[model samples]
Target: MLRALSLALATALTVLPEAAFAAELDGRSLSALWALPFAGILLSIALFPLLAAHTWEHHQGKIAALWGLLVLIPMGLIAGPEAALHALAHTAFLEYIPFILLLLALFTVAGGVVVRGNLHGSPVTNTVLLAIGTGLASFIGTTGASMVMIRPVLRANDDRRHNAHVFVFFIFLVSNIGGSLTPLGDPPLFLGFLRGVDFFWTTQHLWPETLFVGGLVLAVFFLLDSIIYRKEGHIRPDPTPDQPVRVTGGINFLLIAVIIGAILMSATVDLGNITLLGIEIERANALRDLIMVAVTFTSLALTPKEHRLENGFSWGPIQEVAKLFAGIFIAIIPVLAMLKAGAEGPFAPLVALVSNPDGSANNAAYFWLTGGLSSFLDNAPTYLVFFELAGGDPQKLMTTGALSLAAISAGAVFMGANSYIGNAPNFMVYAIARDGGVKMPSFFGYMLWSGAVLIPTFLIATFLFFRA
Candidate 1:
């Protein structure tokens, strides 16, 4: 099936008539029908595992491909093959490849570092570990921190009677909310930085909200976990015997620094552009991707096999992300295009929710709408949409409009915990925990967890911070 898909793509690209690149896809002209493929893929992800677990387990790639083609075929017929091909190529070269490579590099490098011992999953122990991970997330990325932190977390909880909730909170705190403080932590803030917002802006604007929400969630987790731990009167024998906790594979830390440097360099230094198919990609951005590839191989070459083995690292989680996100990146093209169209497009009503009848900025609406769409769409672009909607002036957004900017930033980063697919690390963490024998929730089941825990916390945060 992959071979056939590759052949179809190659055949399409090979036949382009060496003409000027087709005009960019215009979101305003697109009808809501363009979004059906994206919705189909989303439904496929949510439902297939429940109704046909075996088929979904083995054939997720095929299902993703079918949805992708649903977009490509009709798009070719309606928009012409050149435009469709250009859109696909642009998404591939610009968005999908870099994204996967970054994840691959982080997964490789961080997986090589092992916390060489385990701790008991007492409520205090678990809360402290989560707090550490939450703090680490802003320094390293959510993906980086999750890869480095989740194993120790799993090792600590393996003997607990009710352990799935621990990992669920891990996704909430470590993979999503923890990334709110810095551009280095998540893609959405990094996008803001590239658009000329100050590097320290989110750190300043979001610190209080981060503290409040993170602290509140941590307290709740402690209480719930205390109850669960007490109920777990007789726990299973520990699978991994505890040892003196220390860090191993120290060299991967430098490799992680390199990954962070590569990302910053790509954003800050524009070394001109190189056109691929119809898209113009920066040379420095290309170099950054090469550095990512190099880092992936370097980490593999330098790290001892024992380190990754101890960490229980495998290719499976990254492989799943690679396959699934490729389709997601493709299937989402129209949805994003319509979103880019803003007030003139099918999503206008959704867009309009961010303003008041008096034409004032509705900060609470901005927070929830940005967060709501971000719960499903990729948050980086979702953020960019609302950022522009709030008047794309860095100085203004930084000064007088700070609250609205904060709302957007907080919404994109925090509310990503709403679902598995909301943030990059969320699904990857889920996959890893599932592989490690933790009975992680299904797509909907996980939402029940998030909905119960996160909804109330976000409400309190909104009242304290965003209410006009």
Candidate 2:
């Protein structure tokens, strides 16, 4: 499987057109029909598991491949082979590869380090666990923090009958909102960092918003959990009894530190570039990816097999993300191009939605527009699209356009809680919880939870933090 992926990537790189260098399609010339494949992929992700569970579980890869080819074949026919190859190669090399490598590294290393111990799912204990995970998120990335914390939380609450809400709130806080503080906390922020936004920019600007929103959510969760805890008045025997909490596979922590260092090194250092096939790969970023791959393997080599078994670590979640996001990254190219083209493109009216009638930037609109799309789409590229629309100038954005940038960043990071597909870790957390025998909400059911809980909180946040 790995060899096949390598071969496919290699072939695309080798055939990439030299003329395709940093070129975006002329969005004004493209039709809105171009976005259908991307929409199709998103809908398939949202619906197929509900509509055809068995088939989707068995053949998600093929379904994803079909959607990818749907975009590629039509794109090649309309735009020519060179343009198509260039777009595919560019998306694969620059976006999909790096995204997966980071996730892979985090998932592998975090999976090995099982949080071995137990505790009762008391309201205070659960809230404290969540708060710890939330704090870890900004430092390690949400995916990393989610992987490390979800299992222990699940185990801690295994005896509780109403524990589904626990994981739901876990997704709300740890998997999504907690990631708002730093670039490392979420993919959207990380994309901003790569685009010349300073590493500490988000940390400095977003800290207050992160604190306010996260604090409110945590408070609400505590009250809700207390209610749930009291209702279960009869004592039930703990399925996983309390063992003294000691972390196993401690070596993986060193690997995690290495991962963090590699990211920081890549961000701070530029060592020129090497042309592989037609794509120019940065030496620092490439080295970072290499280091991450090494961290993954080193964790696997050193961590005991029993540690993973206890954690219930499986390849299914990562494999699903890998297959599905290949389609998403490919299909989203034209959408992003149109978005980049601004008022001149087919999505002009949609673009207009985020701007005021007098043409000044509306931070509230920026929050909702970036967030509404991000709820269903991958927030990273959605962020890039809006970032480009708002003038792609890191310095200017960090200064005069700070509120607009803040809205975009906050929207992309915070409102990812609106749906399961909004972010990668959301779905992974869902799958893990479901596999562990928690009766997770169905697709629409999950949406209802988010709609009731998250949407109101977000509206309040927009008024408080993002209003112009």
Candidate 3:
């Protein structure tokens, strides 16, 4: 299946006319049907695992590729070969490759580092662990922190029957809200960095919002967990007795530093560009990706195999992300183009919904609209769409429209906790917890939890922070 998908991509690159450069299709000329494949893929992701678990487990890649082709073929036929080729190359080289490489590097390095001890799963202990994980998320990324920390947290609470909420709150704080403080923490912020937003800009602008939301969420978790702990009684008296915590595979820390440095270097350095298959690839960005790949393999080679084995590290999560996001990137091409068309396109109602009568930018609308879409779609591109909608001038956004940009950034990063599909790490966390014997809530069941908790919290936050 992988070979077949590779062949299709290679054929598109080789045979399609390539001189048009990386150009998007004229979205106003396309009908709304262009979005059906994108919707199809999302539905497959949401429902198939529940409806046809064995088939989805075995042929998910093929399912993803099929939807990608559903868009690519029709798009090429309608838009002409050159534009289709340019779109494919642009999404692949400029967006998908970089995104996947960063995930690969962080997942590989973090997987190598094992936290080999359990602490008592008291309310205070769990809260402290969540806080630590949340803090680390901004530096090493939510995925990295989640991968490194989830196992120990699971181990710590293995004896408790009322601990599913513990992992759910972990998803809320560590996998989502904690990432709002820096570009390195989340893909949306990283995409902003790639688009010329300063690396520290998120840290500076989002600190207050992050603190308020993260602190509130953590407090709520502590209260909920304490109640559950008191009521549930003792389940089995610490199945995996607490031990002195020790961390192994210290070299992966150095590799993580290299990954961050590499990203910073790409953002700060101007290394010109090279044309590859008619796509103008930035040299610095290309170099960053190469370094990321090297770092991934370096961690794999240097870390003791026992460390990874102990962590229950497997390639399944990263592989699933890659295959699924490949389809998503392809299928989203037309949808984004139409969105870029603004009032003239199929998404005109959406554009109007987020705008004022006098045409001035509405900060609250930007926050909720960007966030609402990001709850279902990939947050990075959803962020980019709103960023462009608010005018894609980073300097202008920084100086004059700071709050609007902040709202957009915060919305994309924070509201990703709204659903499992909202952020990449959410599903992985859910899957890991379930596999470890936690009876996790189903898709809608999880949303009921998020709706009950996150919605009211976000309402308060929106009123306090995003109101004009």
Candidate 4:
């Protein structure tokens, strides 16, 4: 069975390029429609376990075949034959293939190269370290910094079972929240810079809010840690008193710097202007993107195995994230494409909700809703759509506001803690914790945590920072 699955995946990969090229020639409008079949294929894979459960008494192939027919027949009816065919083709190559490839690379590098470390200390000391780590994550990219530091923080508190919640909240604040001050800190804010929002503007406006919430979170964490610390009395000091307290292999810091430089160069460079091998692309952004790609791959190649070896690295967490998110990106592509095309179906109410209060369309509500969606969806496009909408001239009958932009920016960065699936690094932190044998909560369970902790904090943020 595994062999058949492997062969099927290989065949799909082989056929994808030609299919994409052909569809591109046919027309781009049909691309979204073309992606449905690939979605169905993925859906089948996701549902296989359920199918196997029900059909234990029967042939699995027959059940799968029946399920395929049920899915395809309706897809054909909804999309029409030719359009559905094109959507399937587009899905196979454009949507699913690229997504799967990107995930494979991302997880491979994370598991193979990044090291998780252990720190020994009191719970109070550990919580402070966690706060510091969160602050550092905002300066370096959240995932980049989190992957490197999480293991050590976990190790610091490893002996105390009751204090696991401390790490979970730590990820929420540091890995996700601490990075809001710089565009380089979070991808959504970085995307804003790419779209002409000032690099420092977010920090100037949003930093106060970040600090406010960050302080609140820290206070709560300290109080909680105090309780936990009392339960688990201090351990005897390490007998090897003369031995070095800090671990070595600090040189991996250079690799991190290289990755950051690569990302920045990619964001700023225009490759289209360079005549590389007679291909004059003329866009510096494109060239920068290429440079980033090269740098990322190069860092992965050159990282020492011994450094990663210390963490007991494995591919499990990233693999699960890759598989699930691949399907999510595909399923949501059509939804986003329709939103972009202005179909105005389910999203219309959201549009109405954001219409301005006094002759002008405020878009504060739109900013929040869009930003809310951005937390779970790709925050980039979510930011782009709302940015354009909020920035559009009111004379032209489009939404507009400076306050709206602030709301959008704040909403995008602040409420990203709303769920585990709300942002990329949220799951990365969860994965790292799970890998360390810390049984992090399930999706809704994490949401419950956020709802209790982050929701009121955000309300304070909206009132103090974003309210106009």
Model 3 Cα shift for residue 267 (angstroms)? 1.3
Scored by lDDT, model 1 comes in at 0.83
Alpha-carbon runs more than 4 Å astray in model 2: 1-23, 434-439
Q: Can you give the lDDT of residue 257 in candidate 3?
A: 92
RMSD of 1: 5.0
Best by lDDT: 3
Candidate 4, residues 1-468, lDDT tens digits: the string is 534543443344342233322322222232344334334534443344335545422443443343334323443444445544554555444334333333333333443443344456565777677777677766555654566567667666666656568766866776677767776666666656654565566677667777888889888777777877787776544322232345444434554454546546644555546433333333544444444455446545766767667655556545544454344443444444433333233344445566755635554475468657755554544555565445323222212355676677667766676776566667667876787677788877887887788877877766776555
Clashing pairs in model 1, backbone N/Cα/C closer than 3 A: none
List per-prediction Cα lDDT, in the order shown: 0.83, 0.83, 0.84, 0.55
lDDT of 3 by residue, 15-38 (tens): 323331237565565566667778
Instruction: Give the winner by lDDT: 2 or 3.
Output: 3
Clashes of each: 0, 0, 0, 24
lDDT of model 3 at residue 12? 50
lDDT of 1 at 353: 84
Q: At residue 42, give the lDDT of candidate 2.
A: 78
**Candidate 1 structure, TM-score to reference:** 0.83
Task: Report the C-alpha displacement of residue 388, candidate 2, in angstroms.
Answer: 3.2
Give TM per candidate.
0.83, 0.89, 0.90, 0.66
